[model samples]
Target: MALPKAHRLKSRHDFQAVFREGIRRHSSHFTLRALKPAVATEPSLDTASPTANYASTKIGISISTKVSKRAVVRNLIKRRITAAFYQLLPKLAPGWRLVVIVKPTAAESKCGSQQFLQELEQLLAQAEVLNGHS
Candidate 1:
């Protein structure tokens, strides 16, 4: 079964966790940033844990209405982000919650599934989220 909307953790938790833990994230900023620390300092770390069993990655979306109040564009961005997760998370470890902050730039990127996958590939490589690929 997949995780429901209310159940996933958005990337802001990373910012909060990083702030609270006194750790800095090794990040990849695409108008947005992916900040990561070596170890988590809060209970949420349990969510980002990497184990052997299959697990659904928790995702967060922070697309501001200022970017586009239209539901269609917002939904499209959400769908794109979700699609990115499904394609990339398997190549990563299990049980990690990722926060994806969308900038207005994402509203213009015409990336396909493979492009999105490649973006994720680069992201994981930078965040050290990949398995052996890391």
Candidate 2:
């Protein structure tokens, strides 16, 4: 199943803002970057409620060619990461922009699901981006 629209970070500007202003947390397999959402000067026409948009969280995942030359491998990594995020969704705090970048070592080593979940959880915790004690 696909992630909700509110959870997927789709725009270049949003990605840029997160990358530029976000706090970084590193793990063995990946790096997590996150920034609290900023107030928008203008409301988007696509969404009926600006408050809802502002209150939701968004995420972006990146698996570069440097990590894996094969598209299949990169996609597999993305799927793993997305699946982990899906499981962690409820625990994540809202109104934050988050990005996860897969590292070269992770692609080369072919890390397992357990490792992925652990690394992601640890990174998010260190970043202080998760809600409660996740």
Top candidate by lDDT: 2
Compared with the true structure, the alpha-carbon lDDT of candidate 1 equals: 0.55
For 1-134, candidate 1 gives per-residue lDDT tens digits of 23366436645555465334432233222322333323444545465545423455455666787667787987777776667666665576654545556666556666555665566567667666567765
Candidate 1 C-alpha error for residue 53, in Å: 11
- Give candidate 1's total backbone clashes: 4
lDDT values of the candidates? 0.55, 0.85
Clashes of each: 4, 0
Candidate 2 local lDDT, 1-134, one digit each (tens): 46788789999998899899999989888988899766666766756665763477788997789998999999888888888888888888878899998889998785787789889999988987788746
TM-score of each: 0.60, 0.86
The deviation in Å at residue 83 for candidate 1 is 1.2
When summed lDDT is taken over every stretch of 10 residues in candidate 2, the lowest stretch is 45-54
Candidate 1 ranges with C-alpha deviation above 4 Å = 1-7, 10-15, 18-56
- As for candidate 2, its clashing pairs are none
